[model samples]
Target: MKNVEIGALILRVVLGVTFFIHGLVKFQGGIENTVGWFASIGLPGGLAYAVAIVELVGGLALIIGLGSRVISALLAVLMLGATLKVKLAMGFLGNGQGAGYELDVALLAMAVFIIINGSKLLAVDQRFGKRQKSVAESV
Candidate 1:
């Protein structure tokens, strides 16, 4: 496939950083607060931690291109949950619950785009992927 170098890079970096910031917000309220918040919303405490780690670590992974597709896919699902759990009641219109999930939807779409496109040139994923493919083909 022909490489779209700029588009691939843009999707990875932008979505990665944005997802990372969402995780960073968790640190602001502390784990105790996060757990409490989750419990308040009827989610398990452990699940809350998992969500936090996934957003933080997954975003970092995407940034380094270590597991871009996996990370992107999971984050897309996470955003899906964010919408359903919290934003659904708010509807598409802006509300006190928070701004509508237009931004979250955008991020989900961007991550999905990265998944289908692969990490592309200049990505560590591409480098390792090539090596693995050669081994598989030889075998």
Candidate 2:
């Protein structure tokens, strides 16, 4: 694979695992707590469930390179929301009260890159695209 493809794969897998672990942690640590936290932050508590599901499913999709662009787009939105809503006040490096938005911004950039360039190396999406193209040609 080309260097860019390899870079994309690395970013994809890292982002996927990060999101998957975060989602899993939310559930494992009692999603009710997450819901409460969201409500405390002035967001609808029900949104936690949606966020968790999206992170879990989108992470897995990204890791497997299925609908990578779409998944990355969703993840990008999540990162943006997190940075804007939760971490912006904490600042980029934070004030020692809580972690900053640096990580979120990095993740957002990675997701945006994937959305624009796609993750095709060793990806299911690549195979699926090839199959579709072949089928269309046969027709």
Candidate 3:
């Protein structure tokens, strides 16, 4: 595969696995705790559940290269929200108090890249699209 395609695949897998673990941790920590944390930050507590489910499902979709653009878009939004809501005041570096927005910004940028360039290598999207095109041509 081309270097660019391989790079995209690597990015996709890493982002996918990262978010998946984050989502899993949220679940293990209890939805109530997640909701409480969200409310502490002034967001609607119920959104925690939605966010958890989206992160989990979106991460899976990204890993498999299915609906990657949509998942990336959603994740980008999530990262933006995290940066603005919780991490912005912490600056770029984390201290003993808490973490900073650096990771959020990086994730946001990567998500945006995936959304724009798309996942094309070793991806279900490629195979599915090609199959659909061939079927359409035959019809």
Candidate 4:
């Protein structure tokens, strides 16, 4: 693969694994705590479930390279919500009363990069695109 493709693949894998672990941890730790935290941050408690599910599913999608652009967009929005509602006041450091949004911002930036790059190389999207191109050519 080209260096660019390798970079994209690496980024996608890292992001996928990271979010998957985080979602799994949240689930294991009980959504109640997530909900409580959300409520404390002035967000609806029920949103915790949605966020958790999205992260889990989106992370898997990222790993498999399916619908990566869409998933990345969704993750970006999720990170935005987190940054705005929970981490803006804590500054850049995550060592305090509340963790800062630094990681969230980084994740958001990565997601945006994936969205802009559109899942190139080793991605299911590329396979589908190839098939579509061949069919179109035949027609």
Candidate 5:
């Protein structure tokens, strides 16, 4: 694979693992607490479940390079929401109250990159794309 393809793969795995672990934590550590925290932050408590599901499923999709662009786009939106709604006030570096938006921004950047370039190396999307192309050509 080319260097860019390798880079894309690395980014996909890292972002996937990060989001998966976070989503898992929300479920494992008690989603109710996460819901409460969301409400406390002026967001609807029910939104927490949607967020968790997206993180979990999206992360897995990214890791497997399935629908990479779409999943990355979703993750990018999630990170943007997190930064704007929750972490912006705390600043980039954060304060005593909580962590900052630096990590969120980084993740967002990665997601955007993937959205633009896609997961080129060892991607299920590539397999499907190639098969579809050949089938169409044969027809």
Candidate 6:
């Protein structure tokens, strides 16, 4: 494959995996706790469970490349929240303790790219989408 395609694929997989793990964390923490955390973060209380569910299910959907456009868009928004809510204080240089906004920014970019370009090559979206067009022509 060409460099750009390879880069896009790698980015998608990495973002998918990273987001999935984060979602898993939330699941392990329990929806009530996650919702309380969201409230602490100033987000609306009603959105807590929805956000948690989205993270868990959406992260898996992203990993399988299912409904990639929608998943990427949602993930992009989530990452944007991270950049705005927490990362802004620490600055782009990170917390200086090896934890930084760099990962958040990268995830946002990857999700945005996937939203625009989609999951190309072989992806679950192909079969899951059930397009009349051939997989290569779906896009």
* Tens-digit lDDT string for candidate 6 (1-139): 6777666677777777887778788778776787787789798767866666667788777777777789889888888887888677887887675456888888888889888888765678777556656665856
Off by over 4 Å in 6: 95-99, 128-131, 134-139
RMSD of each: 2.4, 0.8, 0.9, 1.5, 1.0, 3.8
Per-residue lDDT of model 2, residues 92-132, tens digit only: 99989999999999999999999999889989988989999
lDDT of 5 by residue, 8-120 (tens): 99999999999999999999999999999999999999999999999998899889889989988999999999999999999999998999999999999999999998877
For all candidates in order, the CA lDDT equals 0.83, 0.93, 0.89, 0.87, 0.93, 0.77
Q: By the TM-score metric, which is better: model 3 or model 4?
A: 3
**Per-residue lDDT value at 36 in model 2:** 99
Best of the two (4, 6) by TM-score = 4
* Best-matching candidate per lDDT: 2
TM-score per candidate, in order?
Answer: 0.86, 0.97, 0.96, 0.90, 0.95, 0.80
TM-score-best of 4 and 5 = 5
Against the true structure, whose TM-score is highest? 2
How much is 32 displaced in model 5, in angstroms?
Answer: 1.2
Model 6, 42: alpha-carbon shift in Å?
A: 1.8
lDDT string, candidate 4, 6-86, tens digits: 888988988988888888888999989999988987889999998898889889989999898899998999999878766
lDDT winner, 1 or 6: 1
Q: Name the runs in model 3 displaced over 4 angstroms.
A: none
Candidate 4, position 119, lDDT: 60
Task: Give a tens-digit lDDT track for model 3, residues 41-114.
Answer: 89999999989998888888889999888999999999999988888888888665999988998899889889
Q: What is the lDDT of residue 106 in candidate 2?
A: 96
Q: Which ten residues in a row have the lowest lDDT in candidate 1?
A: 1-10
Better of 1 and 6 by TM-score: 1
Worst 10 residues of 6 by lDDT: 127-136
